[model samples]
Target: KKVEEQNFLIRKRVLEYDDVMNQQREIVYEYRDRILEGDDMSGTAREQLGNVVDRIAKDYLEDDFPENWDLHGLYNQLEQMYPIGIDLEELDIESVNRETLIHDLREDIVEAYGDREEELGSELMRALERFILLQIVDERWREHLQNMDYLREGIHLRGFAQIDPLVAYKNDGFEMFTELMNSIWEEFARFIYVVEVETEDHNGAGPTQPAWGSSSNTSSTAAFSYAGGTAADQPSALAAARAGGVPEEIQGAADYAYDEVEAPAHVETRVVDDKERVGRNDPCWCGSGKKFKKCHGA
Candidate 1:
């Protein structure tokens, strides 16, 4: 029930953004047509149109962009179109955020106007939906990051069983990642299945629902292996454990043994705090009284 309300809120916010994007698009088209016919847009029209163009750039940046992109080619062309006034150079047009934002638009809009969301339509709606999904995906990604980092650096716990320390750490890390995967799966399912679009808004007419379960492309359930490949390629924690990899927490714990990473004999490693130092040393002085060895050791 609470999730439903939250979903509604998310959709409401998305719709508002879509509305803004559409307005910007309408204005851009109006002015673009005038310019094509060799007519000058009045100062008022130019200013309004400029505002719209700015939004196109802004909304695209805030939407579904991939990492690492280049915008130089588009900049040159935009400069030619709006030269002497349009000033198409707004924010980092090539940023991942920008590309994602642009990419989020409908395929038609993308093919029609390229990076410019200056004329909104289905593309604008697509952006709003993607923005919401991306927000959720980001949270999931952060959780995955935690598990990956954990798996990549397991401790040498094999001393107890007289096993190879590296092997022990790997196995431990694999287990940890499996547990993390279960947690991630539960959360992902909850968000996707239980969460409903909000119906009542705090100030506005809450989010309008899509035609019930309309989003076919929304899913975030994949095992991730740290230090192997990208997160998506990872085997779920369960899979890793079955395959004999270490647990995630243990793997992450391994790095604790060498964290202050001694500087080269010449490069003075700054004296980090007691806790930071405990990141590797003996027992930490904290009243928990657990030896740093037992508490946070590799």
Candidate 2:
């Protein structure tokens, strides 16, 4: 009874952790779906631009007089982020307040974005926007997940410091999530303004395949080795054990059988070298006891 209670508690904790991840996963998937459905992302891009401008202004203009402002340094930073040319004299800081400067900068940014859209055409610009946003979200989310996992693994150590591990985990996870959101905005702003679009073919070109999934052009086969039972049979045996239909000895045996099985190595497609061409009539390089045409070339 005590062992069963412990197992239940462990499962409950795991489910709690999974619930947090599932909520975040749903939000990301919804964003991706909107992109796939061709939702208008210009508003999102503009919002991110505002965020960038605000951050830059805070960095350079906070608690400083116009005479002491690093206009050249600010220009260099803005130039790196967007294609706009910034001239301090042209901005006429003596005549305009900081609010006006920001408003003018935003207008210039919007105009520059409009020009880029015209250059790329409407359809390609939309596609590029979707691609870039999704790519940045996915990459940053993946890194966030890794950081969360690392935090969870070490969170137990906090117990030694008289802290509750669950509480620590929750607090740290929230902080990490906030940072992730900020990073998403920054990445979107940086890429949207500076991304270069070439005149090459855009048809059938999309985001790169995710690391965990099998490629569309390849087939994956899983192979498992176990001592007591085949992979298919072990699941039913465990179910029976869990249902109390199996005796204690049988349950122990089933658990032992599962523990003895080693983890399966995932299969991936092997890359073939194609630097040198083999003539169809030439001998087979694979050393098959047959003509090239009858062997690999066939």
Candidate 3:
């Protein structure tokens, strides 16, 4: 009967924990469904912009006195996320407050976003916005789930501090979910401003060069012997020869495939030329005062 009661408690605890996850799941699924249904997310984007700006205001302008605020940090935060140029000198420093700062920053950002829409065309910009939001939302939700698992695993430790474990878990979980939503929106907002689009050049007529070497017309194979070649010299020789030196009539062999192989059982040694070999008692050629036997010769 004791074992049965313990089992029931365990099952109840699991269900209670899952209830927390269920609440979060509904929020994430709503985002996914809205995106898939082709909702115009421009309003969502504007709302997120306001949220981010409000956060920046709270972070940098926590003090009532303008002099106490981190104006430089505020400028940097805005510049990094939006392409809008924020000249600190242009801002009216004497009359600045959190509300006015948020308003001006939002205005600049909205203008900058408008400029981007004009540059890319409204249709392309809309498509880019949807793609970025979808990706960030999906990715952040997965990471949030993993983080929640980690939190649940260690949450019972809070009981040692005289806090109820379930209450602590709920409070911490809510904070984490809030942060997850902020990050998803933040990245989605930033990427639309900073992403670069590359266009292909249709006028170029030359054949693309092989990646191994720069020579476009290289068609001959270069053979290298491991026994005779030093590691340092082999790379340059192979690269240079294959780059241009080989005859055009001889086609190149198959490209090299790299695989890990066991080291040879036999130990290999560099063969010293007789003229270069030092006598046992000779002064070291390295210019150390010691005899060869005690120096390199040993």
TM-score of each: 0.22, 0.57, 0.63
Please write out the lDDT profile of model 3 over residues 53-104, one tens digit for every residue: 7787678888777777888887787787777656854667678776777777
Query: What's model 3's TM-score?
Result: 0.63
Name the regions of candidate 1 deviating beyond 4 angstroms: 1-137, 140-154, 198-298
| The best candidate in terms of lDDT | 3
Pick the winner on lDDT between candidates 2 and 3. Answer: 3
Summarize candidate 1's per-residue lDDT along 111-133 as a digit string, tens digits.
32322223333333232223223
Q: Which order, best to worst by lDDT? A: 3, 2, 1
What's every prediction's RMSD, in angstroms?
Answer: 29.6, 23.2, 19.0
Residue pairs in steric clash, candidate 2?
none
lDDT of 3: 0.67
List lDDT for all candidates, in order: 0.40, 0.65, 0.67
Ten contiguous residues minimizing lDDT sum, candidate 1 = 222-231
**True lDDT of residue 95, candidate 2:** 62
What value does the lDDT take at residue 245 in candidate 2?
Answer: 34
The CA lDDT at 7 in model 1 is 100
- Candidate 1 structure lDDT: 0.40
